[model samples]
Target: MRLSRSFLPTLKENPAEAQITSHRLMLRAGLIRQTSAGIYAWLPAGLKVLRNIANIVRAEQDAIGAQEMLMPTLQSSELWKRSGRYDAYGPEMLRIRDRHERDLLYGPTNEEMVTDLFGQVVKSYRELPQVLYHVQWKFRDEVRPRFGVMRGREFYMKDAYSFDVDYDAAVDSYRRMMLAYLRTFQRLGVKAIPMVADTGPIGGELSHEFLVLAPTGESGVFFDGAFEEQDWLSEAVDISDRESLAKFFARMTSFYAATDEKHDEAQWAKVPPERRREGRGIEVGHIFHFGRKYTESMDISVSGPDGAPLYPEMGSYGIGVSRLVAAIIEASHDEQGIIWPQSVAPFAAVIINLKNGDAQCDEICERLYAAAPEHLLYDDRGERAGVKFADADLMGHPWQVIVGPRGAKAGIVEVKNRASGERSEMPVDAVLAHIGVGA
Candidate 1:
């Protein structure tokens, strides 16, 4: 991952078309490039960050017993027709025709397709409860797509479908998935408040949208600061027990959090003055409890204990996998560039050879870079020290290991924290220990 050899095409000036902080920084930092309006080609660094976010989402979903599977990007229009949404979905859906003149579509969402697939199997109540998920690319024909990946027409997404035998069981699954979303955002080093939200085209009565607060966010947000104090991973809530899930859901909803569209003045006044938190927010994830919306529309059913046909209650959970990259930047960046969380940073640290050709400096950087080649980016380019410093800050690795000639000669190096802007000289061994590189 040498900077000189890497395909990172960082720009000195911001792209004029970038209207948002994340969009401008993403372009100038060389994370992504626009191939067309509202579409992008993720570069090496960007793809790595994308994969890291997806991995965190996958791990959290897996922890909650969701089975992972892959679904096609293209789907038969009949799937939507059977669900009675073929004409209702509108222009955002990309309607297409194959050579055979069959009506098809690029799926904007997978509710109908998943319902049909699940119905094809599991004919009895014994297979009543199931959670299936997939991380894949999705396309939507946004009329005015902008804001980089934040509102891209083509993006990566993680969508999960849950099937249960009844309304109560579906509610439990919804609550469980909500807890998982909290854990997922926490692991990604972002505070996302779950607010009651409209289901939109997903057509669910119960819904929650997770919003990450940022000054450049599109939605006005109101919330209680108590959400910042929650440690969902440490909380003892058993998803297997119905009572426990209900209590967990109650505790989560107890916080007064909402976007301007759903804000209630009475609820806001109930919070302590000092604990009130108001800001703008960007949506990163959403979950829905639609009960039998899809199952009933598509005529999907299972056998009940009494030998009667029963429509399975269902829910869908979604995380904007690609949009999160921009959202994280929006929430965390400073004037210099993106301050990536360690969990989702493309590289854990960048090793800057202040004097690239200097024997001592080269020796130190190469040694450190060799220790974790996959996780470290070595700035071995023959660039000025100031240039290297600026680029390191722009790229926003969690840490920057500075190997200047002065320190390199003494078998020491200066370690700088990207977020705190703190630099301290430490022995070579101490540097490895601080960066979690060796041992």
Candidate 2:
């Protein structure tokens, strides 16, 4: 993508309304533009990053045997009513009325709707274990929606529901999901630890909220540093093997981790004093087993092996897809701009033509673009070298391959690592090799 032809309307100064680092950088970087109090129109650059994040979430969900399907943003209120939560969900639920005067809502969550979907199908124990997920926009009318996408009223979310015939089977499914979460966060280049969350009514130690640590986060978090040393991807844990899943889950949960709400002073002391660590964090994902809360409330029953009605044990897992964009920036940015992790970066590297019209500079950039156009963003705009450099750093492409007249004439480029602020001058092909692009 050529910056000269792109729609990245980056701001030289930060927006006054953006009070947080993620919010300010997102505005300055032109990732998102606020249309209303909390609503945003994701610009070209923002949409790409958002999609990249969503794809990663999708892949990990698929890895855990969860099937993907699309669900409606505007859900029928009737489903909520059947579960007796239509009135109880409170103001966060964006209630509305259609032409027929039927009460409706822009779904805050999909538990009721998904439960209804499950009840309509899966009539027997043979269909006992199933997982369904969807990535879609959701709305919650936050009384004070601030902090940009981090606390937006409208956001993209991935919610998955699991159905099982019994409590034991449901717990096994939860462990598998937890393993998936750990692996997903690792790939996304963030340190996320699952903390015990408040399971309101149906409870027995089956709730967890995955919090990504950041300096400016809202919630206080305490966890063992052992979480940082484990490599989830390299662990030989098979999802289908219940024993493997149990061991993996135990390793993660055994660490003393808790958010402010569930913080236990006695438990904190129990953790080895040397391993105790604390920080503020943003909630990125959460998974909880609700047993038969929804299935029983909605009277969703399937025939058991003994031919009697059995309410399926249920759980809901959520990842704030849009919120993650802000969260990643929150956790990774420096004074200059956002330092995007390569996996979720919009483009792997940006080739900055320091002198756009210069034949040598243009030739090298165009050649680099032609070699790996999909992974490269060519800064073809007629701007100053400083402007290009600042913008490149602001957008946080993992690498910046600079083509100046001096290096261009010599058929070489200066490759700058965005994260490290390290620079090395090398041949064009060597630059490509360093960034892992085939020439």
Which structure among the candidates has the greatest lDDT?
1
State TM-scores per candidate: 0.97, 0.97
Model 2: per-residue lDDT, tens digit, 362-400? 888998899988888999988888999899999999999
lDDT of each: 0.92, 0.89
Query: Please, what are the lDDT tens digits per residue for candidate 1 over residues 175-261?
Result: 999999999999999988899887889998999899998888888988889877876557698989999989888888888888888
Report the lDDT of model 2 for residue 387.
92
Superposition error at 80 for model 2 (Å): 0.5
What global local distance difference test value does model 2 have? 0.89
